[model samples]
Each structure stands twice: as structure tokens, then as C-alpha cells.
Target: MSLEIRKIVSFEEETLIEGYKKADRPLRMFAVAAVVTNPWAGRFVHDLKPVVREYGPQLGELLTQRICELAGGAENIEAFGKAAVVGLNGEVEHASALIHTLHFGNFYREAVEAKSFLSFTNTRGPANAPISVPMMDKNDGGKRSHYLTLQFNIGDAPAADEIVVVLGGATGGRPHHRIGDRYQELQELGHDVDNPAAV
Candidate 1:
């Protein structure tokens, strides 16, 4: 399957504080987005497995490289996530098929050296529908303070048969992270550090 990329977009945001809490340095976020033709649009395909398997890695690698570049390199990225929005003519599955695969996700994970799975959002929507990509600490998923979300939209994109794909990255977690880490919570709950269950 060939991906006909119509356009590529990048977004960057800076925050000096959140809710009266100020940080020593500004927090920065980066996201790279792609708008492309949906090969399976306007139809129902029961067997999407092969298509996803083949295309996931290709798109993943391409998007990952762009995001890493925008974030100033993979080494500087601390939190990461991905998202997809399918045009009005496509099914939600068409959006999900791109980002949910390991073939696609692992490139970003390995690049950032993050152990946690990439947080994500997938949906069907029209142009300029606020797209959001949720991020988490690359090395530790349970870090409350490291949780973040990057949101943006393209005024003229995803034209009913297209899809918008995004990859987001942060140089660091939230400033003044006082919420505490998840490993501490696990220890407090008397769960084994190696393998803990949700409480």
C-alpha cells in the first residue's frame, strides 16, 4: 500500500506555568503531523490486518523521524505519544489501524528509549476538529507529573477521504512535578516492584 502524503505539519508550544505554578525553565512540546489519502476509505474491509502490518512500519518510521527532528533529536525527547483522525468518509478503524500497531509505535518507543506504550487517540472527524495526542514519561508510565497532552488542528485537511496522523514529543515532563512517581505508589500498596497489579 502506498501512502500519498498531501501535506505535513508541525506544531510547537511553550509553557512557563500551569495553574499558578511556575517552572524554572519553560516547558516545550513538539508534534509532527501528516495528512494523507486513505487507501481504504469509502468502503468496509473486513481483512485489514495485512494492510496495517505492511504500512504501519513505513508510516511509523517516517513520522518518527520527523518528530525526532522537530524535538531536536530522539535523545532530547522525554515524553511521547501519537494520534490519528480519519476523514468523514472513513471508519474509525481506518484511523486506528495506522497508529495501534507495534510496527508503527516501536520506532518512536525505541528512539526515545521509553518502556511504556505510546499513549494515543484515534477517531473520525472533519477538518480542524481539535486533534489531541496524550504523552507519558518515556521511561516510567506511572509518573503523574510527566503526563501531558499536545493538541492542534489543520484548517484545511483530511478532506472526507483522507487521514491525519501525528507524533508528539516533549523535551521534559511538566515543570515542578510534585505529584510523585508511580513506583512509589506501588511500593506503598505492598505490590511487588517487578510485577505490580492495578489497585
Candidate 2:
């Protein structure tokens, strides 16, 4: 089956830190999302593992692009912060995807080149809540899955404060057609949605 990519939920220009405070260490947070279709969901695909493995890296790249764009470009984010990736439900495995995307970082210790400086917090819950669920088997039958919400935190950065970015399916993960469809619905509802290029 064909897969659709969408921005189900997102946060834009959200200042993780209110005002600049003089401290030895400071924290910044930001949130963003890229809900991808399972491609093999509800259907049997022989190459599921490989497909997920491949798409994981692509998703990471997309997320990094969104983060950089949110920071106003590559030259803006200073290398002085920590970041986090928040998975909506099934997106927790995205951590592996991120590691794959930043594989070059092992050779070069730079966030810009890595295109990502955020760590991932693998948790399960509703996209809008802070609760979590125990890990489950990926091959369980008659089960439902949700999208992942990647969150980033920048600590002690001079150019910017704390930021939080969340990425997940707009429909909260119950086969709502495509990921971007929910985002469109939210936009039409006048929810403050931010574009990838927003600063």
C-alpha cells in the first residue's frame, strides 16, 4: 500500500524559556511533528522491517529540517543545548531513526553537521498529555498504533532559549487516513499551527 506523510500536530515559535536568566546552565525546548503512514498497517507487507528501517532515517531528516527552519536557518542555532524527542505512541522507535540520521555525527562532533542536537524521551501516551504506557510487542495482533511526536530541548544557548517540539499524527493514531489530514483540520479550526519555515 502507498503511504502518506503529514504534519499531524506541531508547535511553532514557542519559547521554552520565558526570559533570559543568568544561570550556570539553562534549558530550552521546542516541539514539532511528522506523522507518517504505516505503509503496511492493516495489510501484510513482507518487507515491513526494512521499510520501517529505511523510512525511520528519512523521518529523522525531515524532523531535523523542521528544527533548523524553526531556528531560522543553519547559522542561527549555537552549539550549547540539549534536545529531546517525544514519541506520540508508536513513534518511540524513532530514536533509532534519529541515530541513523546523525550517524555522521560520530565522525564529526557537531550539531549542525548532525542536523540534530536533541535527545529522545521514549514515552507512550496521548499526544496532548504527559502520561505514559508500558512498552508492548510490535507484532501483537488486533492492536492499534499511534504516531510519534519528536520534542527538542536546547540548553544554555546564547542565541535562543528553551524550546519544545512535538511530532505526531493529528488524529491521535487510529487510522485517520493520512497524517497531514489532521493537521489541516486543526488549521481550519483556527488552532495556532506553525509552518516548518516559521521562526
Candidate 3:
């Protein structure tokens, strides 16, 4: 499939803490989302649940790698935070299936264990998911597309200080922006880049 990635969406440092507070967790957490396009999503015009189920682990691995890179590696993630996978538009069902699959669930557990991060939580939003839609169609041709957003919280990693990594993208294709690049942009916007002490 010819996948196209649009952009990676992340929460600002100030907002990261806000999200952690919203989670009612004692430790700080960073929330990040990845928006990507599934080039084959609309082409098939059928439920892609099977493909998602089979590839969920791969997708999770990619997400974990991206998060690690953004956090400066596994050591930078706090030991008590949550991560989420949010989907939009045509991705609702497929994204949900991916996270709910057996292999994908195991991958998440392994990631947390290996990284020494706190707990991991997986969630999904449908066509009108709560999180902002990070990708848009330039053509606006009513051509339905699938987008995946990955969000995570950085609890108390020294390297994270006050930074949370947010990355998201459309699946089936490369993203318009890299997670690291987006983080830098957020920093330039004067987002609270200092790591906050655990709540």
C-alpha cells in the first residue's frame, strides 16, 4: 500500500501536565498523538479489521519506537504514566481492533516492561474522536481516509524534565511531519518545556 503520513500532533508541556491531572494520576504524564493516512483504507471499501488485527503489533512497535526517540529513549519515560492510541474518521473501527488484538496487547505490556515506564493504557476514538484531527486532505475530495494518533505521558524521567512527547500520523502512508520535528516546533511556540515534579 502507498501510505502517506501527514503530521504528528503533541500536547504542549503545560498541557501535558494538565492531561496528567485530568487522568487523576499522581505522577506526571505526557500525552502525544500521531496522525497518519492509510492509503488503502478507502480503496478497499470493506472492513479492514483483519489487516489491522494482523498488523497491530507492527504498528505498536512503530509507535513505541517513535515515542522512545522523542523521549530521548526508553530511559527518559517516567515509571508511572499512560499511553493511548486515538483514531479518527475511517480509522475508528480499525484502530480499535488494532489495540484490542491479542498481539498488540502483548506488545504494549512488553514495551512498558522493557522501558520501565509506569502503566500503559490503550484507547480509541471513532470518526469524530475527541482528540483534534491532525491531518487534512488538500484535495478535500470527500475521499475518506484513516488517521492514527498516538498519545503518551512522561512521568518523571530526568531527560524529560518537563517535556512530554506527542506524535500522530495517518497509517497507510508516510506522515507529513516527524514527531521530533513537531516537538521542536512546540518548543519554539513557548510551550512549557520544563519537566514538572510528580503530582
Cα lDDT of candidate 2 equals 0.34
Residues 60-80, model 1: lDDT tens digits: 899999988887889989888
**What stretches of model 2 exceed 4 Å from their correct place?**
1-3, 12-28, 39-48, 79-111, 114-118, 131-199
Clashes in candidate 3: how many?
A: 39
Using all chains and alpha carbons, the TM-scores for the candidates as numbered come to: 0.91, 0.40, 0.40
With candidate 1 superimposed using the best TM-score fit, by how many Å does residue 192's alpha carbon deviate from the native?
Answer: 3.3
Candidate 1 minimal-lDDT segment of 10 residues:
190-199
Q: Each candidate: RMSD to true structure?
A: 1.8, 19.9, 18.2
Model 3, position 179: C-alpha lDDT score = 41
Of 1 and 3, the candidate ranking higher by lDDT: 1
Residue 150 error, candidate 1, Å: 0.8
Candidate 2 lDDT over 5-80, as tens digits, reads 5443334332223234342233222344544443432333344455545554555556556655665554443321
